[model samples]
Target: MNIKFVCFSLIVMLFHGSIIAQELITPEKAVSLALDNNYGIKLAKTDVEIAKNNADILNSGYLPTLTGNAGANYNLDDTEVGFADGTNRVLNGAESSRYNASVDLNYTIFDGLGRSYNYKQFKETKQLTELEARETIENTIVQLFTIYYKVAELVENKDAVSQTLNISKERLLRSQYQFEYGQSNKLASLNAEVDINNDSISLMNTTQELNNAKRDLNFVLGNTIPEDFNISTEVDFNNLYDKNELLNKVKDNNISVLQINKSIDINTLGVKSESSAYLPTVGLTGSYGWNKSNNNAASFAAYSVNTGLSAGLSFSWDLFDGGSTITNVRNAKINLESQNILKEQLLVSVVRDFNNAWDDYQNKLSVYRLQEHNIKTAQNNFDRTQEQFKLGQVNSIEFRQAQLNLLSAELSRNQAKYLAKLAEFQLLQLSGEILNVEY
Candidate 1:
């Protein structure tokens, strides 16, 4: 049973391994794939299409409506008739039939420019859809870049841990050899072995972290998570901008702010549309028809056919509707004002975010620089200590401390690098330029 289970597991592993051959993707490709498949972006695109459909002038109630009508009826009955001459006539199995057909047309000639305002409103609304979709795509792009860097960070830490583990393993082997040669005490050999085990555990944890980061990246890309993959290790840290310059860009390009600006225009049009209700509406109506009737009644049988054409102009003035039109216009004005207020708020928010992101990136970059320097110093110190340990000048305790310091510096440097990268992406997102990011 054990052998069978082992074989089954091996087969399963092979299948998954074959299917999940490392999917290498650059950050640019990740963003492109996400923009194409992300559910929110897809829905936003559909909203834009719907707005475009609604913007068609033909859908703005500008065209005439035409309809065709036709009908026929037949009946049979006994009938009795009394004429004014005081004579009565009776007929059996009386038959009658009627046939009619008509074509009708109605056209609205005027509506106080309401249709024009509505058309303009739809156009603005369509632009709003585009801006909203841009916002979604930008958000996803920011996430892609940040998470890609995060994976790089975790992988860096994992490599550092593995390196530390290898150092510990070498120290353990040296300790064992020294103890066998009676150069190091047995206690030193046991301590070295314990450190090796601890470093191995740390390596395992860092590997798990890297895997989680990759999974998160896959989620953002709207793709299946693979067992393993490699991302570019290079992170750009030189994309710096002055706060004033960034604010200028944000004002012109922020998607949320642009959407609010467009909303104000749409709401202004809404007021105009409502105000148009106070004026009169004019329409043209026309119809042509043919009708025929036939009857059979022993002495009063009759047959007739009639045809006619009719056309007329119709007008309606909604002089009053209990003040609803005025109320609607006032409400629209208030909403328009609200949109302007929101736009101001968004501008302030975007500026604040941009500055904070820029500052955070700079701060993390500083930390990264410090950690980088610290790692160099620690590496030098560890190398000197290792040589001393080999020559019996430094104890194993001092060498272990040096190794720990180097590992800590390495991990902190990796963390700072990724954090700075995240801040950079956030700045781009606020500027509405994340989607333009390349590798």
Candidate 2:
């Protein structure tokens, strides 16, 4: 009997090893695959890049602008008309056509610090966009772990159902032998058969559930169902961790928190930038080029050539705007206040979430250990009762109850294990550990 238990334990170990071997994916691989292929996350990243490009456009203001121009005018004729002299004065130029061309440049010398403030706003906006992307990525990350654990849990439950069916079949075989030999009652044998039938039905239900879970996981992973992909069945679920560490980490890592705070900075900069529009701005303009004239007309032979250069300063001011600037400044302040309130609310919610996740993890871990121990004890009791029944020392009802105990123990074990896994992942999420973990 002891040898049988050892053999059974060895079989379990071998099965576990095979399952582990069939597992081809790691948490890191799954996350990397999902990030690269997931539609929502990929699109979010693209939006961040677009925002970054927008920020790059602001740099153009720092560079001087260069341009060129050309034009010409024409008149009817250029009869040599000159000062009153006794001599026939001739001038090769008349109102035939005039041409002008120039290369010009303009550069901002100052703008009441508008450029500086606007540049700052763009930078802040860029930072916010990046944070938004990260927040989206974090959401996807939590989803990946959550779905992975759910699928794993269902698979575990299916395995438990299989084991339960096997035990029920074995009990039925034992009861049939006893009844045929006139050593057991018919009702007991009937009950044994009924238990086997019920277990079979449960196995079918469990298999269906496992299939549904697999399909759901495959959908999220952007992959075809593998039909036999192995799932890791165990994770350390009872390790005590410091809540203080998590609190400290959230400040440095929470994208939502960082983004809302930076939004106030953006609003403040916006008000400053808008205010600068009312102040006087200084700039420089310069041009230098040559001019030529051409005419296509009879008696209009024209010759003209000119060259010049000039440079000067320019200024601009809005003067007044019927309190528009004042309204803008007030709105910016209001927005800043709203952002501060948002940050405060987020912090409170995150703290509560962490505490809840931590407690759930602890409770699930405890239940899992209890279920593990229960399975061992129940298995032993079932085996002993079957032996006594074979010896004609126990009744069929006691043996059937033993079988039920074992079945319940196995199911509870699977449920507890899965619950613990979910709790651990949730804890990781609430504490920002999921985001910090390298994929």
Candidate 3:
């Protein structure tokens, strides 16, 4: 019955009559839109930028600090004085004024190389943020493609159901015509009508599922308003990956593993930074100042001014802090140990996930190949049954069963195709290759 042509025609009619105005979205376009618009990726990139800003040496306390101070005062008072020689003096409207200004600079000379450790820590933190951002991008792309393929799968399934519906409709018409001519019984026509009803229900269910999948795809694309769109129904099954190579790449390049490694490095630096606290801190301090005072009513001096520059080297030692430094250093070491343990655990998990995805991919690919063969056989069987029914050599039930077998095979093939594609994407995501793929 040339079901492929029937399915394609029905899909064309369905779209033209129902959703002809919808935009067609390609996988590349979906990925590009998600990269530009997805909120999670945007936030992750923002975090990377913040980390980059914090990576400055200034933030690591590697630079000198300069501060300036200035002040002025005015006073008015009445004064009375008694001298040691028994002489008394009284003054009215005594006025005084003072002004001062200073600029100071302080630079840490040494602190057990803590500044260097801090700088390294900041750089590592920046790198960690960048990895996190990459992880976000990878995750978004994976989700986008997953939903994209789901839409494609549902679209194909809907077409298959629509083809069955068309077949059932034709069968019903033939049965009615035969009964009118006294060739088929009333029961035969009634059964055809019931089958048509069932096919219609299946078509409706497939359509509903397709619609829901499209909505989910739109959400993942970060659409502000849901828009009706058609996705390319082509499924690519050409990916070839070696398990050993994938495992090696995941060990070195997986985003989560890399992030944990960075964390461990940062923690190591933390340990060094805390340990530095036990050493004496040496600093260079310098200041320049100007001071002036004036008295309107004074016996010894009417005005005075002072200006000076001072410089010195300062040192301080944390001789004791009630075991606080010891506690902090111990805690930092413990945290470093914890990060090491986490890295070990993460490596194990990464390997486990990759293996699982790899197995799923292989299984799905095998199933898809089997379904491909099964569909061909089903199509041949349906064609034979269809020809025999035209000659009245096969009953209506036999023909319908063949029709259902063909429909089931088509659906299974469609499902297997997409499931295999999804599994492939999962492998890419686990290996962190999803980010490196050309959209």
Candidate 4:
């Protein structure tokens, strides 16, 4: 059964042509697809990876560094003389070379509390990068949600126009049949054709609009025009769910809010990192070396041996190095405070955004419901007028008006339905439930 479904899906995916396509897409699935495939999301992920690598580099400072050295030298002069028992012997007038090798180890003995604080700063910076990436994704999700709904809206409008065009064609056919039997005037036949032509032009214009909307949606999804892909008209706008619970969810769920909170954490750490700059730091370091020289004769008699090795502890003090420490500390504190203020601002903004979205959603819902009611009334009126026209109690003009009323109601209802759905999706997006949607 699963295999059959997969095969069926593939067939539908490839079956884009003259007929209308209707593929089901939920907000969550749309977002997931975009995050995986969208150019901006991929770039944001790259940013995250870059931050992780930087963190690794900063953490490596805690490890010891080993350095090796080797050198060879030629003293063109016979520069060596030696005495073994009692007498001094003259060395060569010829040249001799000395060679030496050693390895040095540095492990940060002590400093005026610079490395520790600097390390803390590195950690905070890395964390800040991560938060920035999350923030980017949140913004991208908003854009994606907007474009997705717009495409859905355009598609629904196109369907509505097509339905109206079909009705116009039926009217034209009936008028022609009547004219042939001498039951209707030639003018009625001409008027019916005019209606059909007008509807045809309107449908064409709507198709162009639908294409433009699709192109824009594809651009943001990092996709080209997909062959044969269409959206389902199954969304239920009549579900009058509450906005209060969703608003509550935004406090902890919204990615932007969480990202800002993460920034606050980074800033808090930044203050600590900077204040530690005033304290002293300590560690250990050492090095070893061996040296030798050889004397060869022209007028020489000398030899050289090992010089021996030495090692010691090292310390650094910033007794006064430009007063940057105080300035940096002050700067860090200010930044920390700024981040806190930013958090408060974002919190307020989230609430306002939700309220605005809720108001718009409710209005759209009302319009959709009213359109639904209008559709029934329009259909009933059209039926009565059609019966009157058949009995010759009303002319074609009155019958056409009643039919147009029904068409207008349907078109208006489609617009209202999709607009309401868009508002609902936006509300969910603000609440961060797009990620949690299961089906």
TM-score for candidate 4: 0.81
Best by TM-score: 3
RMSD of each: 5.3, 6.4, 4.9, 6.0
> lDDT of all the models against the reference?
0.84, 0.77, 0.88, 0.74
Off by over 4 Å in 3: 1-21, 224-226
Order the candidates by TM-score, highest first. 3, 1, 4, 2
For 333-410, candidate 4 gives per-residue lDDT tens digits of 898888889889998999999899889988988899999899999999988988888788998789878877887887
Q: Give the distance in Å from residue 46's predicted Cα in candidate 1 to where it truly belongs.
A: 1.8
Candidate 2: stretches off by over 4 Å: 1-23, 57-60, 68-104, 179-194, 224-227, 287-293, 296-310, 392-398, 437-439
Q: By TM-score, is 1 or 3 better?
A: 3
Write candidate 2's Cα lDDT for 245-271 as tens digits: 877766656666677788889988877
In candidate 3, position 110 carries an lDDT of: 97
What shift in Å separates residue 301 of candidate 3 from its native position after superposition? 1.9
lDDT of 3: 0.88
What are the runs in model 1 whose C-alpha is more than 4 Å off? Answer: 1-21, 224-226, 296-301
TM-scores for every predicted model: 0.89, 0.79, 0.90, 0.81
How many residue pairs clash in each candidate at the backbone level? 0, 0, 0, 4
